[model samples]
Target: MRPINEIIVHCTATPEGRPVSVAEIDAWHRARGWSGIGYHRVIDITGARLAGRPLSAVGAHCAGHNTGTIGVVYVGGLAADGRTPKDTRTPAQRRALAAELMELRDRFNIRKISGHNEYAAKACPSFDASAEYDHLFEGRERLFKPIVDHLLQRGDAGQFAQSWRDQLITWRENRNQPSPLLSSQDPDDLFGHAVEAETLAFQRERQIVADGVVGPQTRNEMRLALNGRPPFSALENYQR
Candidate 1:
């Protein structure tokens, strides 16, 4: 393995919840007249890590820091409307990113890590990765929290919220866990009392804050437990 000095984190700058892959990035880079994908690795929203440029070769991610720095980009940096910069990482992405960073640090003895914004005036990552991951050097286990897109609660009905509730139900059922929130016959998407109860129970079981709200932490933990499978692959596939 090539000796690396710094690890730079970046974002794909796509809309929130958008799914991107290394192949797509490779084509984009090729269009830009670069060899291929600039980053060494790209982590999709579902937490799937895809290999990009070879680690043995120099990176083209940063302007001046390519020689000794490895670039890692996560999909999704834009807000819901897909224009504004935002920290749009999902729970799965958070865990996978933390793990990948830790692995890189250990494997390469990397001492410095920063977001793409730290070097350039642009907000590529759209979050302070250095400060957010500062706990890693202090032996912190899990460093960052999930990026909450919305809060799912009683009477708050929407396709996104409903999809989250449905995901919660699917994750619970798949794990062979019984939840009153789920219907015995079919999957339900309503955010009802049972959903709140199950959400609290899930949170408590995972030692998360039992606030009964599908906030960042709760969403993160749930997706982590679910093993970060693509929550809506069908929709994503259809879009593709």
Candidate 2:
């Protein structure tokens, strides 16, 4: 056990939905003068998980933070059409992905799950895990609704979770960045309201009275979530 701490999700930037070989990934990394594939596993459309990097080492998938994370890539089905419907992670692949994640979750004591796009700001997965990944496990949406809502508000929470959010916040603070916070009054637009809604939902779901406010309780959940210990409330009514 090399003390794995994080699991970062990604999509092959390629157009095809086929399984990729280890050699191909290796060569891709080598060509960039990197050590190896930036992911620990690559899940093809058929649900096969191919190991990319060794467990002992960190990957290079996410730009800012890869030293403590495990990267997993999936074959992408996203088309150039710009609509997300055409891109889907096959059920078999999703199932395999879930199983693989569970194994890693147990092995490494990981608690949080995230997509690549969230970390550095690239939509490699092309689909929203918050929006698309819940169906694989029934009633999962309710489990992740708060987290998902918060992430959705940022338009990149599916990928970043909290680690990158903290990083982004740090970046903003360092640069004296003003909040690009969107308007939250309109329920329909609810633009940039994911974090707020999610925090509130999480608190309320935890029987803490979800005020839709991001206070200490919500921040604590986010912290624990990044480490993979989602609140028990999230597991309720969730399909295994």
Q: Candidate 2 overall Cα lDDT vs. reference?
A: 0.55
Residues 1-240 of candidate 1 have per-residue lDDT tens digits of 655767889998999987887778877775654546778877898998777776665566776566667899999999989889999998999999999898888887677778899888998899999899967745422442221134667766667666777776777788787556576477565677877877777766665446677753456566767885432111122122
Q: What's the residue-level lDDT of 22 in candidate 1?
A: 75
Question: Residue 214 in candidate 2 has what lDDT?
Answer: 41
lDDT for each candidate structure: 0.73, 0.55
Top model number, TM-score: 1
| Clash list (residue pairs), candidate 1 | none
lDDT of 2 by residue, 31-131 (tens): 55344466778787678777666666545577555656678777765664433423457888778878887777667766556666666566767666534
Error of 2 at 113 (Å): 0.6
lDDT of 1: 0.73
RMSD of model 2 against the true structure: 15.4
RMSD of candidate 1 to true structure, Å: 19.6
Q: Candidate 2: where is the Cα deviation over 4 Å?
A: 80-86, 130-240
